[model samples]
Target: MRARSHSPRKPKPNSVMGSPKMKSKSKSPQKKHRAVINQLDYLNSQCHMEGCSVSIVVHSTRFLICRHQLCHASDYFKDLLQSKYGSEDFYVTVSSMSEPTPSTQFRWFVESSIPCPALKDISDETLETCMRLSRRFDAKGLEMRCTKFIVENACSRQPIVALCWLNWALKHKFDAQTQASCLPSVARLSLTALEQHRHMLTEKIFSDLLAAKLRGTYDKAVQVFRAIHRMDHFSVEVDRCPRCGRTRDGMRVKVNADPCRKQIGCDRCHRESCEIENKAGDDLQAFYQCPHGLVPLNSTTDECHCQIPNLAHHLGSRYYFRSENGTILNPPPLSPHTSRTFDPAEDTSERPGTSYKRQTSRDMDRREQRQSAVVVRLEMLVVSLQPEESVRRAEIVSFGSSVILSIAFFYIFTMLNAFTTTNIALLDKSSGCFEKKISKYYGQPKKLWERFSRAVSLCSPRLHSVELGAFANTDEFKVPLLAPSEDCVVLSLGIGKDVKAERRMRDRMSQCVFIGADPVNESNADLFSQVGKFYNVAVGHKNGSFRSYVLEDVYRYQEVAYMDLATFIKLNVNRKIVDQMMMDVEHAEYPVLPFLEKGGELSQRDIAINIEIHRPTSEDLQAFVGFLRRNSLSQQWIFINSEIHPFFKHIRLFMINGQNKECRRRFWEN
Candidate 1:
């Protein structure tokens, strides 16, 4: 197809060929073969990538020029194309892969379906025909562009692939314009690149959240640490004595027990007998230290008898310890292997970027803030938590999927990152499971948390609301996000429990936007409004509700027109508080999620919420808490804080923020 070069004047071609005509006729075929080989060599130069590795198939078709030499099943490439576009589109693309000339390509574009038999059963002769056709049409340039695009677009979801394509595109001088146009073709080549890639995004991707959490503040850090634990599958706590199987409690006693309750044995009854009941479960109350030493399996439920440890045999006996052989016992380690695993009792060394100390100067204020309180149990650590296994490979996988190459597919990474994973939770304390996943991405973290708020409300410390402590609380709470100002060190609550903890907290917070309750009037707004206002502090009154909010009420509650009072609060407070919120509204807290999600008011905050559970069964609580958990509002401390704020000191503060504001590992132990 090379045009002959000539001077400005038209040449007399016959005059020159007259003598050489005989020679020219003999050389044309040989010259054609050499041209085909040269083109193939050129293509080979660019086919260095893993995906592009292919031997030049010397194929030729009457109407085709460039033939792909890849040797997979015809269905294989068809399938890959089908995934990127429809099966129809794939066939269309492949149908003309062998054609080299733009002249025949027009027919390919016109054909409804790609002709199959052409190279479907590729043979040496057919390959050669394809190569001949390609040279005639000079289609290699077009083919190369198309192939590169399809593969790259298809791989957009795979971080590795995406990174590769990014690098490749740059290497080949493919501009963004080319990337946009060719991305679809790339996607068509790699079928699996769809939503499946999201799963590949790990904790490493969310280092920003971690950085924010570790910036300095403790409450925020604790909240974020818990969240990181949740995200990384390193936070949920389940106790199982990996060493033994006690019919009663699953975990083994790693250490020797005190002398008083010495019925140590690996029988079903002893397993749970001494273990503390975390949330709630089956009771093991059927034993008596009677002479026979007989122990009933369960107090009233089962009439079955369980074995008792032969404590009389030895001094420091474990469940597995034995004497003269009697009945075979389930194996138990000599002692318990009960030391903490993921979330240990001992505090980990503080992460870098946070170091602050306590101040008695704030003591008087701390004393004043230390009003009445509930005997806290595992404060702040527990939220809508699922066992590490709850997070699915599929969920993350989708985040990185392609389909993005197509303009039809929305490339929304921010939305994927904003998802709050709280459902499909395997409770550390109880049994029961939930289901389902949401499609589409939401950019704001608060939106995801609001969704999970219902789920979190299922547990004891139902989330009334939450705020990031100028840190990780951003997903659920509306706090000011700011860059670090001054030395700006944030100490753990235990490390620096100022009596005026609230004031101290308010004073020291920096690198954060202030998030406070805007005091929206609550009496008139409907459930949704109240919920929205509650999330964003702009509302004038307590934005959220009392402790009576229920799932059904939210679903069936009357919708009331509302104003943006909560927005005002955020602008006004300019300070974020990580306090326990009491939202026991009859129906108020459920509906405002949409509103709170908007206006960025729900950007920061973690109000350790105490929502009133009003369902007839545990399923409702489960559903509610599951919702909250999915939304990223982990259910922290679940309890009533104050009945009334000090403004009415004569009585009490209902669900007021805790004065201690200090949450550390020893919280439960203390």
Candidate 2:
């Protein structure tokens, strides 16, 4: 589909015609001086090129121009003109740069800087001519305008023009927008037109067109197939051979046959011999060669490739679709392979050229009798091996099905595991920072003897009086909460409609600075103003804009800014150790537990975390408590309250162990 190209012709010195002399008919000396002065003025007015000390003559017409303008347009022109011409010389003649003349295009190119060229007024051919000149001179702006005019106007009106432009664009590597405009028009060309202009198109363009056409043809065929199948009620029947009474799947093609055996078996033993096997194989082959051969339900017309004569009589409309007289779009070519030339001599049974005449009814009956006798003899021997073959096939199928199911189940299990895992960063061994895999259960279990001893001491009055830690039912170790003082740092997340709890904490610890945050607390902004800094942004599992559904029905759903606890703490608190933090976000606490465990923001303080668990199921509550208990950084919890409601519980006063004396001792010993 690629086209051949020719290089631009170089200008010849003799191509430029010599300028004619103006005869002086005026008798007065004043008139002659005025004429010379007028000619000089005309030259200066027409030439706009900078550093104009010369006139360039092309194809007999002379254009007075500047040296810099010519150089700016092309490196070839700059090198040629600057190397040959001098400042003293005022005139220079150049040969033919274009056919007929380059004067018209050259004038436009030099004068284009004075005013923007109106490309709409020019004919497409004229525009193309200018484009070629611009291409040669490397005039980028002129070429772009010319290309735009061709694509926007000419290509839409005339397809042939588009075809020509496509070739030009490909060769020159035109801008992407112009090429995109050419592709769709070229793709819609008819097959005949495509063939005619194949050489003008690039291989990629031609292939894309062909592929689109092929897909259209295939889609139409499928439509016809579906229509026929839907209209016919009994199209799903299995196909059977009339002569052998065998279905397609039960029979196979024969590779080797003995022509001499009019009977089913070979000359030796007449039982299920090589000759009978060959007969079965041959019958299978003949069925396969027929165009009306059976196809599976899940297959398409292309996969079947049926082309048998009298297919309508043999298999009815179920086997094929008649598309020429049909409404199907872009039907395939006639005679899929090649039309068979009909010859009366070849058709006649009496012909003696290369084949025998057709058998009479009497001859057919005799052959049938011999075939029946051989089939009866072979049936006994073949029937014995049928059961064994079927059993072997079943075993193979079962094994393959089992393997497929196993692989499918494994893939599903892996995907479920990945989806359920929480998004959290782990502490790196070198940095002691949370920056790896999501935290699951962080610390190791306690000894059996220690658990037994603690259980035996349950009779003590202090043990009964002490508050239970969060996840007390689980095996995780506990830490008690420490009361906050006046100089403590507090971070309040998800403040509900009421600010009574927050106000009470603020009044008790007046010296502490509290940062209160709530997504839906814009109406109560005035209340939190006196407490500390208040933000309307919601805190969630991650930093993103999450959809916050308003239950009031008037405003509907809206999106709000959400930042995770770790990020909010990092961005606002930086390296400060939070003394107490309270969270009441509806079911948004699960994803933030690991962040509090490993993040450096609260590692130096006994942070009391008070959070309300909304609509908590048994499994969810257990998992939440277990996560808090297993955290290595937060080794203690004060109290977990279940007095509010069985389903909606709260961890009222949970805290981490702030004292690191034991930790330092262990580190030094290690």
| Candidate 1 least-lDDT 10 residues | 490-499
TM-scores of all candidate predictions against the true structure = 0.19, 0.31
Q: Write the per-residue lDDT of candidate 2 for residues 127-173, one digit (tens) a residue.
A: 54555556666667666676777667744655676777777776666
TM-score of 2: 0.31
State the C-alpha lDDT per candidate. Answer: 0.31, 0.49
Question: How much lDDT does candidate 1 score?
Answer: 0.31
